[model samples]
Target chain A: MDRTAPLPLALLRGTATVLPRAVISAITAALLRGLLKTHPRLLENLTRLEPAIVHVIASDLPYRFAITVGRAPITLTVVDRIATGADAQVSASVATLVDLLEGRIDSDTLFFRRDLRIAGNTAVVVGLRNVLDREELSIANELEALCGPLGGTARRLARALEVIADSAGARLAAMHRTLHPPGTEAQDLTADVRRCHEEIAALTARLGTLESRRKRQADKIA
Target chain B: MSIRYLELVCPAGTPSALRTAVEAGADTVYCGFRDCTNARNYPGLNFDFDELCAGVTYAHARDCKVLVAINTFPRAGDESPWHRAVDHAAAAGVDAVILADLGVLDYATRCHPNLRRHLSVQASAANAPSIQFYRDHFDVRRVVLPRVLSVEAVAELIAETGIETEVFAFGSVGPMSEGRCYLSSYLTGLSPTSEGACAPASHVAYEEIDGRVLSRLGGVTLNCFARGEPAAYPTPCKGRYVTHGQASYLFEEPVGLNAIEILPQLKGAGVTALKIEGRQRSRAYVAEVVTTFRRALDALERCDEGTPTGQLHGNTEGGKETCGAYQKGWR
Candidate 1:
């Protein structure tokens, strides 16, 4: 099993810190936008009522993005910078955003208790929530493939060649999270996330045992 | 000359409401087209273009005025619909256009220079500087004050700026800053300032669990009511929440703002008009509130006692009444 994806994991844990927050946010936004483009079908399946303006105000950065949709359309704005003219705006941490996208966090319980904020278009935000509902599940298997074991390993030798790029990306992510505190609401939201992680671990163990038994029985039949 | 009987500015959400208000006692009735251009964008409410023109003629024949409320803020790249609503309002020969947006105000001032403009309450222009800014920029003749101000503040503001003020004397209390709030947007992704309806009926669902009705906005539970208790409209600001570990109504309790008992005070405060707030209400509700307030105003003129305090409480969502921020000491 490739278990040592050190760079990205280290970045998420707030260890690597050589890059600036602005550059990191730009890169992250670009990554999300790239993901959207690659997964256009996912967007099409989401919702018919597109907000005219979609604002993304990252709490861990100084930038705010205003995205507009339709003609005389709906506007959604996220305000970490806290400007105006958004249909839907949210303030949360990078980890929480990933967790939310992955279906690891429930937007309802978290948002209602003040984990995230939907500012401009309340109905549209609520309606489109299912779009990002299970994004983490979609990318999990691909990410796991990139994880390499640590030390005295073939993956370690391969990483030496990729060290420059991976290390740089990790450093950038760490620095951005430090600059912005991910806001108070995000703090409240993450309070119960650890419990959820433990629950997922337990479920995974049960599924693994079931798969293993099935494989053994198939071998006997062969 | 005795200040011309305070112009009875009434609200009309439907074509029937228009005639009802005019007949009941409204000197002027304001309404909007059947789109987001108007604040009360409720289903089966407001006017179509033809209906508005006919309503204006009918009101005019009775020597009453018609004011079209195209009050919602226009979206950033698509302001044509709002501009068209104003053009249509003027073309229909309505007395004035009530506006709130800066860009819309600028457009109206230049595009239809002859049109009279009343500032919509959504503008929330409370102080002299804010009131003067609209007056200097758009030549706004009268300002509809947000419900947050007290009678004392209203008097001081009018004295300082000499701007005509219209105070909300009847109907629901909107807790947040009008037009600029996004709390509702955060939960539902639709807003009154832009979509022209807060806690829109489309996204609202009511579920009965164990004999209690739980009102949900966008599927998030807001409040639960007992079998016989009167349920309030699920406005996000008025929804119950946990603040400092105590589950309470954090923003505001769902109550109506009825200022009938303070007619003399508002008149003394130099309010030019008393506005009734239910445009989405039925014609019967319009007639009742307007007729009651009309009689109260007439009583004020003759120095007689009027509707007792708390008389209109049952008309409210929660069967509760507040002087609102009008008596700021209530805070």
Candidate 2:
């Protein structure tokens, strides 16, 4: 196993193991409450939806949550394990889930591509998707709101960090390209070999013509 | 100058869109309930009960009529939802109810006799006799003609039936017979007639592979578009498929219908209303389309030959527009 890969994996596992379920559940519930408060349409639409327990699982992470909607004060409870019975169970990578929540990517596109998997009652899932699509949900904004008085400073710092991270990622990609420069070098070698073969063939053809012409002239003189 | 103006019917997916359409000079605005009562049942679309009521009140106050679309077919065993939708639409005090199903139409006629009923395009009542059946049986005030007729055919139908005719002025050029398309259902196991959604959002997806974008519906790749090429809705009819060892658009190309230039012809053909299709679109789209058409209709009323077709080109699907089936040569 690669040492760098294992380090990140071990760190993620450690974090998952160290975090308490109740703490995560409380945090999730609190965040959801804040989201509902800021965007009342989310809750209002949910009230119109049929009562269902929707299990949202982050496939790449050790995170799962079951949300009970279609009632007053919709609740979110983080589950340590997958629920036995769920009206709808939607699973995707953390990045994908974040993209969906942030409205950066459409869920329907992901669902069709098999990047997002939805099992059990499709109607409930459809209803949930419809309700969520109506609102532009941003976890970053939600987190910033949690910062209270320091929200502006926190947002600025976050933006600076993002810029730095993006540049670093681009640099790393460039370095990677330098290390393994795709298949261009191999393609160039093939083209060079083909050119050499064509040159040799052309020279052979010209030499044969010259010898044949000289032989014909010598025969005429004799 | 007694010039008979064609009524400009526009779509409104939300309450805000309804107001936007009306403000942009829609003579009539049509919408549906938030459920599976009407086509264009995408997620985050349509109006709830309160929204519909408010939309009706808002439109009526401005001398604009609001038509409620309860156009989807009622399921065999359960007709309560359909019945309830009709009741709610009537209670909302809409100017009319656009219906397709025979049973639903009969119920509306029997129950709410005073409410005006327009035959939805979903009924596929293209011919005079079919449209006459609806008028005779259900007392349909107007027939929203299917998008399969030519200008001449529409005129002939109007002349023969002597009933009001509404034609699709703009939107997707549906080649298939309305209310009879089972292509989406075949792929996704969801009926468009019953679910009121074709190529439903839940079953539709987009993926990028090798710089090409592939639109899929229910895991079946419908169309693969080159980079920077306009992508269409992943409907089965507009999909490219292998035929005779060549891959090409088998049914129809992804093109939108825009008949702004032909407003005078449609008016001359005795068309009562010109329906602009796109309730699932944004309020901005509603405003632009309604405003452009309003200008065109105003010009027609003045007997002017010029129309603002160039301004409406950007709003078309795939940035390409055609007078589909309106011109005989388009067939």
Against the native chain B, what TM-score does each candidate's chain B reach?
Answer: 0.95, 0.97
Question: What's the CA error at residue B243 for candidate 1, in Å?
Answer: 4.1
lDDT of 1 by residue, A37-115 (tens): 5566334424344535666554564556565543332233333465766656655765565555544444533433334
Interface Cα RMSD of candidate 1:
15.8
> Candidate 1 on B1-331: residue-level lDDT in tens?
1234676789887676788888888878899987899887755456778878999889999888889999999889989999999889988999999999999999999999999999999998988999999998899999999988889999999999888888898877765788788776777888779889887856776555665666778878888766666567777887877678876787888788888878878988989998888775555566667777777777677776544343566567676777888886665
Best by DockQ: 2
Candidate 2 lDDT over B1-331, as tens digits, reads 1223889899887676788888999999999987788987866678888878888888988889999999999889888888899999999998899999999999999999999999999999998889889999999999999999989999999999999989999888887999999999999999999999998867866556775777788889998877666666678999999889988888888778888878888888989999999886656567778888888888777877666565665556566788999995843
In model 2 chain A, which range of ten residues has the least summed lDDT?
Answer: A1-10
TM-score of chain A of each: 0.46, 0.67
Q: DockQ score of candidate 2?
A: 0.07
Name the lDDT value of residue A89 in candidate 2: 81
lDDT of 2: 0.80
Candidate 2: misplaced stretches above 4 Å? A1-39, A46-222, B1-4
The per-model DockQ list reads 0.02, 0.07
